[model samples]
Target: MPTQILKEQLAISIRMLERANHIDFNGHMSTRVPETDFILINSAAVSRSTITADDVIMIDLEGNVIEGNGRPPNELPLHTQIYKRRKDVQSIAHTHPRWSTMFTIANIPLRPVVMQGAVLGEIPVFPKSQSISQQEIAEDLAEKLAGHHIILLKAHGAVVTGTTIEEAFVRSVFLEENAYRQYMASQLEYAHSLEDEDIQKTKNVVWQPNNIRKIWDYHFSKL
Candidate 1:
């Protein structure tokens, strides 16, 4: 029953991300199997919008499929490396959202442009434009992602990590939203970021369990 629920949550997260345009055909999401070295992720061929629990596969840290028949994503190392590095991170969302990707190639730093962005603080850029297909590259990316919730891959995309699937999914959405707003604001004048005090105060209220649940529930309902 627990595994079934996890699969459902994975499916819902994929659908929500696709609907929000955080990902299309190229992105992926995964969750570490509780108390296990396995991860459940969407299969390579599965489109985010049409993915079901059956489309999800279980794989080991080495990117070897442990269960399910579908092939894992080529960027499987990205998920495995983060899980190996951050034990507290239970879920991950690796996407190529337009605005976030734009910021990466535009050489603009993603800062706290609004209350939602405050929860994320300063986002880091991975400084690499290539796909993270090698173990070494994945490790380097993970190192850059250390102590950060979101990291932008130069000309690639962004990766969001959280202690829960909902948190990771919500962070992915907000990352894109923040980037979109910042991009728009840049057109008018130099956009200012929230001060540290404002970020801390807003994060205290916005990142609470109840608030995360509210956003998670609302997005899941759309799936």
Candidate 2:
């Protein structure tokens, strides 16, 4: 994809995340500059909802700003280190949704109770509560991420990775949605989760390109 298009998509995804209440003032999103070590991410001071294509900054794998104005996110290492460690991840989203953050702080496990939750069989929770600003902490977080696409930052937020902006954005949204349902279910006397077979049956279909595109379109329309 073109760099201009990627910037636009990134901005749209940020706005959509804010609209869905996945991020407030303290969230960041980024995408790899196709075939390059550089990434386009939101500025540190910009609110997710107010981000525009012009507000996105391009930085190298070493965290050096290559283009655009303003400071990159303070958690720049969080995105850069993941790009260095995971060759498959093309986009990433770091946000602090209420329910997901609640689960993170409470140290509660997230179960695949909903169909969408199936994609996240067992979301890992990073035990550290400090900011992942340093290179070493970011690398440690990436190690905890292992082969998973999403991970919870204890008392901080959550991070979701994908091969595309739509994939990351959709997964982030669903992760929060699942957390919301889980919180509500906890209020009841009992709650059951989907069986492994059921989750396996729907996993492929739910993440298919057409389905992801549908979700992307729906959310993008809302922006």
- Residue-level lDDT of model 1, residues 1-223, one tens digit each, is 2777888899899999999888888899999888789999999999889999999999999988999979999888899999999998999999889998998887978888888898886688999889887889999999999998888999989999999899998898788888888888989997789887788899988999998889888888777
User: What lDDT does the true structure give each of the candidates?
Assistant: 0.89, 0.90
**Model 1 CA deviation exceeding 4 Å by range:** none
Candidate 2, which ten residues in sequence have the lowest lDDT sum? 188-197
After superposition, which runs of candidate 2 have C-alpha atoms over 4 Å from their true positions?
A: none
Q: So what's the TM-score on candidate 1?
A: 0.96
List all candidate RMSDs to the true structure. Answer: 1.2, 1.0
Report, for all candidates in order, the number of backbone clashes. Answer: 0, 0
Best by lDDT: 2
TM-score of each: 0.96, 0.97
For model 1, which pairs clash?
none
